[model samples]
Target: MLFRQLEYFVALARERHFARAAAACYVSQPALSEAIRKLEHELGVPLVRRGRTFEGLTPEGERLVLWARRILADRDALEHEVRALRTGLTGELRIGVIPAASATVTQLTDPFCTEHPLVRIRVETSLRSRDIVDRIRRFELDAGIIYADGVDTDGLTSTPLYQERHVLVAGSELLAGSTAAISWAEALDLRMCLLPKGMRGRQLIDDALATRGLVAAPQLESDSVATLLEHARTGRWACIVPRPWVSTLGPTAEVRVFDLVDPVVTAHIALVTTAAEPASVLTTALTGTARETDFATVDRRQR
Candidate 1:
């Protein structure tokens, strides 16, 4: 019933441990337990399936946790709005970013911070597109930078941020005789280090190769784009990455960057936020920032 009780319950659901949840809430174990008990009594439902150790939430608790998250999110948004009306935006804006788009997130965050100096920004850069979308839906992230293609956007608002074109990067020795552009099949033939199949970038690459009846059998697979690039730098493997990343994280020496051709693949990168009505103030501000951001400079440089 009380907001504090809801906080404790949500924390418990998240931590899945009574002691850790109590620690997170900065309250004693007994206090947290008593609050949840009171909340359960008020709702007339057994929220937790308990034993000596922490058991999982009951069915009713599982459903109510979703509502509890929404309520807490709404409460924070209300506080942010009221505080902003008097003192400018002053809360943290939590953003989840897909790793392929990690280098480019600063394009939005830098300006957002400059405009609202009091607002704090937290960027989680290692998420996949699906993970970012899931977190946004769960009210865990205010916005996300993710690949726009092949992701379920139902109940979400997406603003196109930029187009990402894949490029092949490898040590000079590995690409000693390669041309300015290489076909997907040729790239696949090299000793390659590629993102795992679960990543959106990898999926796009796989789809492109599938058109040629070819599959990427990389020498190594990693979830991190940086890791793939690192392996490429060793002269033993080649990796494919977004062309824009070449300007930022691409190696300056010992590497040859080739445009991926013979069916060049491009994916739309987008900023996504939940489609909930009465959008949070931070989400509105971030959406506006996304609209006004000038990616032309980066685009031109990448060209």
Candidate 2:
């Protein structure tokens, strides 16, 4: 059968309703049903249980669904490679990244564009890890930069890009009267600004603070770290942010980042791509730049 038939099968298998499946396939229900019937006849297998409504796929149908996903993915990859041969590194690379790691993507994108100028780059920022992986698998996004821990990447491959280092940032007023490091107990009293609870970074923060049986009282929550830093600079605010981002501050004359004492926390971020297909040339180069990026925090520590 053709790729369109397999596409129709996967859409039907997922929705289990003719109307919904057809809508997802961007066709009329009658059109989708005919295609499925054609596919079953060609394969000589009963693929779906039919009546007035779509019931479910048979055992053989379920197995074909799995194979269909693989075949479709490979088919798309082959088409992209062929197009690249004629066009030279042209197509689209859709990248999803954790909202906290959004800023770092700029570093990779610039160099990547230089290498594959013909490719179009799209970036989406999301706070959830599962959502990132889901988007990557469903063909919504070509790749994602996300936390590697506790994310199920069943058919995805990852290369560790950097270790996101954590640090304590506070209003200059708080730091002026205190030591170089801020202990957890001492930080409990300050007005904290953290990423919304949806982010994995916030979960890491909770994990770290749970040891002392203390949770932060966030007076403000934002997805953008730059905005959080601006709030700290302008108000009596304190935040625990990744150390690598400190360089973004033009000068921390009005703000101060202190070491979080006891056990310092770090999050490992990686570039993830679907394992089923060879990456398009643009995506491959983009992911490679991600792998080579120097999380500046590491170098500063080395010095």
List the candidate 1 regions with Cα displacement exceeding 4 Å: none
Give the winner by lDDT. 1
- TM-score, cand. 2 vs. native: 0.76
Residue 195 lDDT in candidate 1: 88
lDDT of 2 by residue, 141-237 (tens): 7888889989898888887877776787888887688887778878778888998886778888888899888888798899888888888887488
Error of 1 at 29 (Å): 1.2
Residues 230-263 of candidate 1: C-alpha lDDT, one tens digit per residue: 7877777789998767776543676788998879
Q: Would you estimate the TM-scores of all the predictions?
A: 0.95, 0.76
* Candidate 2 overall lDDT versus native: 0.80
- TM accuracy, model 1: 0.95
Residue-pair clashes per prediction, in order, are: 0, 0
